[model samples]
Target: MKKLISMIAVAALLITGCAKELKVTTAENLKVEYGEELDNTKLFNAKESDENVKVDKVEGFDAKKMGEQEITVTFTDDNKDKEEKLKITVEDTKKPVIELKKESVGITAGDKLELKDNIKSVKDPVDGDLKYSDKTVEKDGYYIDKGKLDTKKAGTYEVKVIAADKNGNKTEKSFKVNVKKKETAKKPNGTGNSNTSNNGGSSSSNPSNTGNSGSNTGSSSGGSNNSSNSNGGLSNNGGGQKPVNPAPHQHSITVTGYPDVVYSNMWFEDDTEAMYWASNYEGPNGDWAGFGYSSDQCSCGMWSPYFFNVTTWE
Candidate 1:
């Protein structure tokens, strides 16, 4: 009777051991992906006891902290207490961003123009103060429609932008910079500066000019472009090389050979004779002894039409 009783107790203990060794499955499948984040603590497993009893919470088992779901399940008489560790990794697959900015305006050729911009598009893939260049006339992205246009020259300038993403994915956008000749500067009074100068044929405000009787043509105003400099800025005033044109050595008359037009612009007969060809200069009074040009449109020694040059008079 004593031996039978002892055997019954041992059988009960063995059954309990087998129940605790049952393997448990996680409530949800372990998942890993790029650009995704998960809680390290709540990831857990689901299972049943040997009697098929469902488990709610294990007394001291934790599923979150190991940076992934990791747990060891021990097997009993039914198995060799096998244990395994599971991992849920998050992958990195996001790319970076890029951008550009500048002012807006129309452009023309034969007219000096300037292009300028500050590259400031931001993104995680690249460093700050990002650098980019382009030729598109549009406002943003890789293309810049604005730039310094050399009005004297005509053609299309290709605008391109090259940049890299966080994963080193290279991107480039291109646009066209067209340059063509525009209309000449209009004369004053909406008539254009071609036919008249300041004071309307009376004032030679611009010294180099004489009298423009034929018609005032070919002059510019308000047409400008940014200058090409270290900082990339707009350039309105012209800053370049001169054509090496020299001043005339002697003065010659071109009024169909006015014989009285002397080399010194004097009649030479006398101060009174000087008055004869006085009309050759400018002013309605026909004064010649003035030594200085009266006709605001003072032609060059080579007979080249004198435009408007304020520096020539003084």
Candidate 2:
């Protein structure tokens, strides 16, 4: 009887070891963009303990759909079929694109200026074209950030256009609006007829009087008219010349060893300011100065310090 009990216990142990549960390793709570392609190899493991496993099929996953859903992955594990469920979220995180008609526009003072006219179009990859709005809180459209554009004043004003899509992705672009002073017509001089002789008609009646009158008219009127004409020419010449405002020079700077990484077409008052900005300008990675270095140590495996080249144009 003891020998019979030992055989039964050995059989039970063999059954338990042969029937061990198979646990599949899978990625949990995966997130993908709305239009990303699905790959089975990246989703889950295809082998268990050196045993060959194959992914047979996947279901309930839509690349075009935006939301969270449960996906079923079917695979053959060690000659046995099994299934695993995974939660995946599809989202739209792309920001909208803003195209402006002009980066800088000029208008005469007191002229009508519409802020929306500057925007050429606002388009989203998933949401199509976005509409214009007066307020910034609109989720599906764009709006001007600065309040009340003053076109009546003569000065330069900066305007920012902010666009947002349905998924809360946002993009911003800045532009300038220059308001020029209106020109007015100047009044003609009142001394134009002062050079005419008043005694010419009386001199025509008598020959003796004509000579005296002619001499007096020529002497007095010629001097007075010449003086008036000289002063008027000087005044008109001065008033006709307008003061010219110099255009801002375009400046650019590039990082050493990275030609593609550059800031171009930036406008500045002078080269001094551009140099200052380049010295302290911080980019996506870091500032131009001390690039590829951590404190005093060179992180790029060399003692090479990053240098910059600045170019400017009118």
Candidate 3:
């Protein structure tokens, strides 16, 4: 009876040593972004200690949408079934928020415009600032419609600024722009400063040229000095002809996008005189002195407001 008992104990030991082993090690809760594909191997650390062990099947998971899902991993060891389960969370259901602050602005006909200036901020609950750039104007994105103003013609127009977030959330606003007609200068009459050496229109020492009726002449002293002054004045006169761009006039001129720049309240002689765009010179304070401008609208740097409330003499 002692020998038989020893043999049985030895057999039990052998049986225990031959038993198959299987294990599944993974976190209880896993997280993933919305719409991301799910992989089984990456989902869990599963393995069988015995060479004959195999994965039988896996079930109880649907990651198609945003929600919590349960995954069951099943395996077989020597024809014996074993199972384990884990929880997966599909998050990212929050949408981005955008606010349009400066929804509208009025600019001159020839001025450049930026639609994004309308946006106060672009924010998201999950991902902060979106760093939105011009690329946001592409398809499934946003854009500005510079409608009807003709940009070259003076009149009232409706400009539409639109935007969209990464999750397809969208918003838009409209601005009414009033482009007033450009001001033009007129020819002076022979009544006032046209008199030669005297206040009246008569002088032989320096005969007044009646080429154009109201020519102004505060004849600068000294011949060469006079010539230089005359040349400068002529160049600015829109065409070598004296201009009577006198003013107690008010203009609501605004400059945007370019900073530390300069622009002028020019007095064009005619519509065709628009060629004098290069004549933009800085004015003194209380005028257009420290305004901003960019020769090319497409590449203009920063954005800021430059309001011109001009009051000019002759």
Ranking the candidates on TM-score from highest down gives 2, 3, 1
RMSD of 2: 15.0
Q: Please give the lDDT score for candidate 1.
A: 0.38
Cα lDDT tens digits, model 3, 1-314, are: 99999999999999989975455455557887655556655555544244444556768665445578877877565567678777888876555566665323445667775656766766654445656545435423556666665755665567765655455555566755545455558787855434443332354443445443355454444343333233323333323565667865443335555444344444343322222232233355334333222232112232222223333444
* Candidate 3 lDDT score relative to the true structure: 0.52
Which candidate, 2 or 3, has the higher TM-score? Answer: 2
Q: Which residue pairs in candidate 3 have backbone atoms (N, alpha carbon, C) closer than 3 angstroms, thus clashing? A: 188-214, 189-214, 257-302
Per-residue lDDT tens digits for candidate 2, residues 183-289, read 67979875553543342221234456555644554565443432223332333332466446798633333344655334333444433233323334345445232
Candidate 2 Cα misplacement greater than 4 A, ranges? 1-23, 46-54, 62-68, 77-79, 134-137, 146-148, 191-314
**Residue 198, candidate 2: C-alpha displacement in angstroms:** 11
* Number of the top-ranking candidate, with lDDT as the measure: 2
Best model number under TM-score:
2
> Per-residue alpha-carbon lDDT of model 1 for 238-293, expressed as tens digits?
77653465885554444432323223343232222232233233333433223322
Clashes of each: 42, 0, 3
The lowest-lDDT stretch of 10 consecutive residues in candidate 3 is 296-305
